[model samples]
Target: MEAVTKYSETELVLLLKQRQQSAFSYLYDNYSGALHAVILNIILDTELASDVLQDVFVKIWRQINSYDDTKGRLYTWMLNIARNASIDTIRSKNFQNNKQNRELTENVYESAGSTQLMTDKIGLRKLVHQLKEEHKVLIELSYFQGFTQDEISKMLNLPLGTVKTRLRTALIQLR
Candidate 1:
């Protein structure tokens, strides 16, 4: 395939919607590194991050037509996909043991972003570290880990109202 450097992001999106192999190659080459870094920040393990990244790309490929440019840009949509996929993986039962192991030794609440196993995620860690403990818990469980507010309430053994309040409060504070 010839180099696809001429088209703008919009054109690339159109090509992607058309299922052009060259467009996909170009998108992967340009965006994979940044998306992979975002995944690694959430997953905190290379192998798992790699697996999640692949899934994100596959979703991007399959769901390209669902993208509405009126709502957001392509990279933004892809980032959301990567972030959500990583969160979903972390929230899975398969990773519950790892989560418990981390919880046993580290007070992830005190500085939820303090643990930086990956150098590239320092920015993400620092941002999370600034949140209050309750705010961090709500954000971690509800956003980063992709748990529904109801699931978060059950997991944290909090009342549903309390879970929703905390989650809402956390976002307001973050903003």
Candidate 2:
């Protein structure tokens, strides 16, 4: 295969559409870091994040034909895939069980930092402190922990509307 550095996004995407392996190799070389960071922010575990990143790339290859240029750029579509996959990872039963096991042994000061992986992963953890108690929990459940509104409501023992309101409020605060 030739040097893919010279390939433009449009050209690379075209090659991907044609199922060229070289283009995918180029894609992984170029975009894997950014995609992995996206996964790490949600997953907060390097090994799990790596696993999710692999799944994200596989899904991308399979679903490349479904991408719509009219909707957004290729990277945006890929980023969305990474984000969704990371959220799915956190929401998995295995993840929850593993998380609980870690929490049991985790020290108070270290717990937040470990679970967050660091504010460096995403700035949300730092910004989360600025939100109200209710709003902050809602955001944590909905965004970081990948809970649906209904699931969040059930988890928090609140109505769906209240959960949605808190999340919206929390997001507005973050902005």
Candidate 3:
């Protein structure tokens, strides 16, 4: 068996920035489990989360130069990248369509009595509906339907700042 190689965070960052393959391998071996768990928390689906995890690593590799050690720890930076990538994947149209298709297939297989269970699964929407009409619309468009703030702004003919402020206020209310 080959001996395991260990690197300090600084060493790992340096080697990674230098594009050393072994450093990347070591980084993956040490960090992927934690990163995968973070992504899985957001994405929920293992296959999709795995894909996001791969994309996260690719982003880490390519964006290593942009990483500033003075700003934060290496793992924290990677964690943010993994989290953002997972959120981006879930917010993507393809992921939403695939999710809806999967839900439809599952519903077809389920008995009629389970329809209520599916409806209950939409509890988040139910909660959002309790908000004022404007806030509700923003939540539905941005969270449920995965529309970006800019898209919501364009669709509602509102300024981007207003969209962001409303969304932030809606989230604060939800919390």
Q: What does candidate 2's lDDT look like per residue over 1-175, in tens digits?
A: 3462668878988999999998899999888988987677667778989999999999999999999888999999998899889877665744556567345223222444456436543655678756776776777666666657997787668998888877888898888
Error of 3 at 93 (Å): 3.9
Per residue, candidate 1 scores C-alpha lDDT tens digits across 1-175 of 3463767988999999899998898999889998987887677778988889999999999999999999998999999999888877866734565557456223434334454444334445556556787777787666556667887787777999998887787777766
- Which candidate, 1 or 3, has the higher TM-score? 1
The ten-residue window of minimal lDDT in model 3 covers 104-113
TM-score of 1: 0.72
lDDT, each prediction? 0.76, 0.76, 0.74
| Ranking of predictions according to TM-score | 1, 2, 3
How close is every model to the real structure, measured as TM-score? 0.72, 0.71, 0.55
What's the CA RMSD for each of the models? 4.5, 4.8, 8.1
> What are the clash counts of all predictions, listed in order?
0, 0, 0
Q: Using lDDT, rank the candidates from best to worst.
A: 2, 1, 3
lDDT, residue 153, candidate 2: 81
Candidate 1 segments exceeding 4 Å error: 1-6, 93-121, 157-162, 172-175
Task: Give the CA lDDT, 0 to 100, for residue 59 in model 2.
Answer: 98
By summed lDDT, the worst window of 10 consecutive residues in model 2 runs over 101-110
How many residue pairs in model 1 have overlapping backbones? 0
Tens digits of per-residue lDDT, candidate 3, 11-83, equal 9999999999999998898889889877764455689888889999999999999999999999999988986
